[model samples]
Every structure is written in structure tokens, then in C-alpha cells.
Target: MDNLRKELLRPSAESKQEVSGKVVSYFAILLIGGLVGTILIFLTVKGIALFTGNHFSLREFLTGVNWQPGHHHFGALPMITTSFSVTVFSGLVALPLALVVAIAITEMLPSRVYKFFQPVIELLVGIPSVVYGYLGLTVIVPQLRQMFGGTGFGILAATCVLFLMILPTMTSMTIDSLRAVPQSYRQASTGLGATRWQTISRVILPSAKSGILTAMVFGMARAFGEALAVQMVIGNTTVMPKGVMESAATLTSVLTTGIGNTVMGTAANNALWSLALILLIMSLAFNLLIRLVSRKGVR
Candidate 1:
């Protein structure tokens, strides 16, 4: 009788476990969905409120080059252009170096050397943005001033600092992507009398192209969204940049600098909120691109 009771209780316990797992899974899904939905709703409502409450036209907001709050002009074309220019230039500067470093670590470096340096490379990711900013301000800015003869604070300084900040991310992602390429492919390439370098360049790289592109996207996104470090170096000028050495302001920098200064519900404040909305949309677009690329790679 005791054995019979134990058997029945075991079945009941198993059923309970199954039910609990289902409940937990559903709860987790709901929790994540709720959080995402809340964020989307909030951003959407606030962005719309900016236009509704302030009577700002979206076209003028996007096309306006001047961003004077006191003058009642809130053109963000300059900021938009600066943000794209800095992000693109920084990514361009960092991507090749990152790829080379990643390839060296995975393909050329000895196991011991690779292990010793990989952690050091990753440690860079943990360094505060302010530290990078300070370093750029103290070290890089002065060098630029001496060499190029400007205030030493401009798009160049911002781009260089952003390059350093995004390098670790790009390198780490590229390394992982390269490593994920099947060893079988490398072996087959080698078996076909291809040189190691040729194999890596043609076979491994092509196989990992999607991931490399994803890494570049992520790096560019990091460059685009960076605020504190960039604000510290970029001259924060409202005008469109005339050259790489000229003063410029990014969307993020403007938002950060102006948010506290503007009164609530005012047009200036609403414009800043609009900038926030633009950043959010940019991030979402990058994320969507990454997902599409990843799916295509998998297929």
C-alpha cells in the first residue's frame, strides 16, 4: 500500500513540475513582452506629444540647420549630419584594425599569447566613457591642437575617441564570428592546396561576412549613441561641420546638453524629446538590420 501511494504521488509530482515549467515560461514571455511594449508606448506617446503640444512640423524639424532655442528655431539638420558623419568615420577607422586584430588572435597568435591578451583586450570594454573622454581631452586633444592648430576639440577628437571606444566591441564580435566558422571549411580549403592566409581571406571571411557586418553595425550604433565621451570632445558647436577638424554636435550630445537647460513642455524641450525619439528609432533600425542579416546568414 505504501509503494502504491508513492507511485501515485510521483505521477502527481511530475505533473506539477510540468505545469510549473509552463507557468514559468509563460510568465517570462509575458514579462519581457510587457517591458518592451511599455517602452515602445512611452517613446511613441512622448514623441507625438512633442509635435502636438509644440506645433513643430516634422519636416522643419528635420530640415532646419539652426538649433537656437532662444530664437525659437529648432532645426536639427546639423546635429543629424554630425551624428552620421562621426559614427561613419569612426566605424571606418576602427573596422579594419578590429578585423586585423581579430584575425591575428584567432589565426596567427599562439594559444598562450592569445589567452594572455584576450582578457586585456576585453578589459577595454569595461573602461568608463568618461575615462576615454578625459584621455582624449588631455592627451589626444592637445596633440590635435599642436598638429592641426584648432581648439583641439572637434569632430576629429570625437571620432578618434569613439574609434577607441568601439574597437573592443568590433574586435570581440569579429573574433567570435570568425571562430564560429566551421573548422571543416578551413580544412577543406587547406586540402585544396590553398594557403592559410588565402583560406582565411576567401573561405572563413566570406562565411563570417554576415557576423562581421553585424559587428560593424553594432560598432556604428555604439558610436552613434555615445554621449558623455563625445560631448566632452566634440566642440558642441551648433553649425554643420565644415571639415573633420571643425566643431560639430551630435544628436546625443545636443540632447544631453540641452535637456536640463530647457523648461518642461516648452518647444525647446519638445525638440530635445524629438532628438531622443530619433535616437530610439536609429537604434531600432540597427537592431532590425542586425536581425535580418543574422537570419539571412543562417539561411
Candidate 2:
């Protein structure tokens, strides 16, 4: 009897130990993944620094306007300006339209309308980025050419293309967020003598505010990273574009097409690498800001 009791207890103890080992294994996997990611990021930055031997001077980066790589000039004012301008204008064009559509679909419209529109929305999402770029080049550039000095390629076209690209993301996010707003909150706002517009502008939007911001940020990031479409439409003019009509090149376009296009050992290659680093930093900062905002609450 004693031997049988001991055998039973031994299996129970071994089972518990096995479960504990699995739990620890899961945590160890998480730890290892995080460490690998951190190490890779650190090494990338360190490698760039070591390879260039260029001091990471923020002042030089921010204030410089001449960004030619052949002569060791790394000014990026034009690229920064164009990227931000295109993104901001695109977001502006997309956001209100997205919000209104989301409201119409999620708030006033019947379930039937949402069902009908969901397919279209998903269809828009399925279209590739290259197609959008091609459309901008073929369709938009021709439209611009007729009226705008026959260049057909400029920031204006890029902005319009970006607007179309950004709309789907903004609308999808907005619809999801707006739909998630508690019905009770809407009803309570209505009960408190608030008009529909007042209720929507105040209670409902505030509830979905974080999601809306996320949508905008995501749109901006998407616009920033968009190389093909904007590259196709924007004239690739190295000089800052004079108004929306002129051609302009972006960091991505510059990096891929500049002197680095051929043999290495040249100034353009170094400059292309530097431009890439700058762009990477910008991308990283935007992602970091999103995380910080998410954790600390957007102020």
C-alpha cells in the first residue's frame, strides 16, 4: 500500500514539474525574441555610424538645404518639406471624407448599407500600391499636364494620389472605431438635450479619438514610406518645388537613383546611405511616438 501511494505521488509531482517547465519556456522565448530585436536595431545604428564616420549632428541635418551626395552636401530641407506637405494635405483630404462616410455607414445607415459597402472597402484594400502609382502616372499626370504647364508631374499630383491611398485606411479605422462607441453613451448624450451634431462632435468622437489619431498616424507613415506612386508622379526635381506644380524628388527616390546607382566608393553612395539613415530615423521616430502616445495617453 505504501509503495502504491509513493508511485501515485511521484507522477503528480512530475506532471506539475513539466507544466512549470513549459511556462518558463514560454517566458524564455519572449525574452529571447525581445533581445534579438534590440540587438539587431542597435547593431544597425552602430554599423551605420562606423561605416560613415560622419558625426551624427542634428543641427547640420536640420538646417542644411543642399542634399547632393557627390559633393558631400547632405541638406534635406526639400525632401522633408515635400514629404510632410504631401502627407498632411493627403490626410486632410481623406480624414473628413472618411469620418463622414464612417458616420453615414455606422450611425445613420442600416446594417444593409454596411454589408453592401464592406465589400467595396475590402476591394479597395486589395488593390496593390504599384497599381495606384501607375494610375497616378497615367491618369493624374495627363490631367495635370493639360492645365499645369504641361509637366504633368508635380507635388499636386502626388498629393491627390496620396489622398486616395490614405482614404481607405482612415475610413476603415474610423468606421471600426465609430461603430465600437457604446450605444449607451450616444443615448445618454441625446437625453442630455444635446443635438445630434453636438453629441457626435463631443461624446462620440472623444471616445474614438485615440483610434482616429492612430488612423491618421498610420496614414502618414504609409504616405511617408510610399516610394513607387509618389516617385512616379512627383517630377523628381532635386530643387524644392515651386508651389504644387513643380517636380520634386523624395528621399527614397534620391537614395535609389543617385550616384549610388553604380560603383560604390563615391560621395553619392555615402550620401545615399546617409539619406537612408535619415529616413530610417524618421520612420523609427514616428513608430516610437505612436507607442509613447498609446502608453501615456495622447496629450
Best by lDDT: 1
**lDDT per residue as tens, model 1, 52-162:** 887878888899898898888989999999999999999999999999998988888887877887798789988999999999999999999999997998899999999
lDDT of each: 0.91, 0.78
CA RMSD of each candidate after superposition: 2.0, 3.6
- Per-residue CA lDDT of candidate 2, range 110-162, in tens? 99999999889878866888899899998999988987766888889999898
Shift in Å, residue 115, candidate 2: 1.6
- Which pairs of residues collide in model 1? none
Candidate 2, residue 156: CA error in Å?
1.1
Candidate 2 stretches greater than 4 Å from native: 1-62, 264-266, 296-299
What residue pairs are clashing in model 2? none
- Model 2, residue 272: distance off in Å is 1.8
Alpha-carbon shift of residue 31 in model 2 (angstroms): 9.4
Against the hidden reference, what TM-scores do the models get? 0.94, 0.83
Candidate 2 has its poorest 10 consecutive residues by lDDT at 43-52
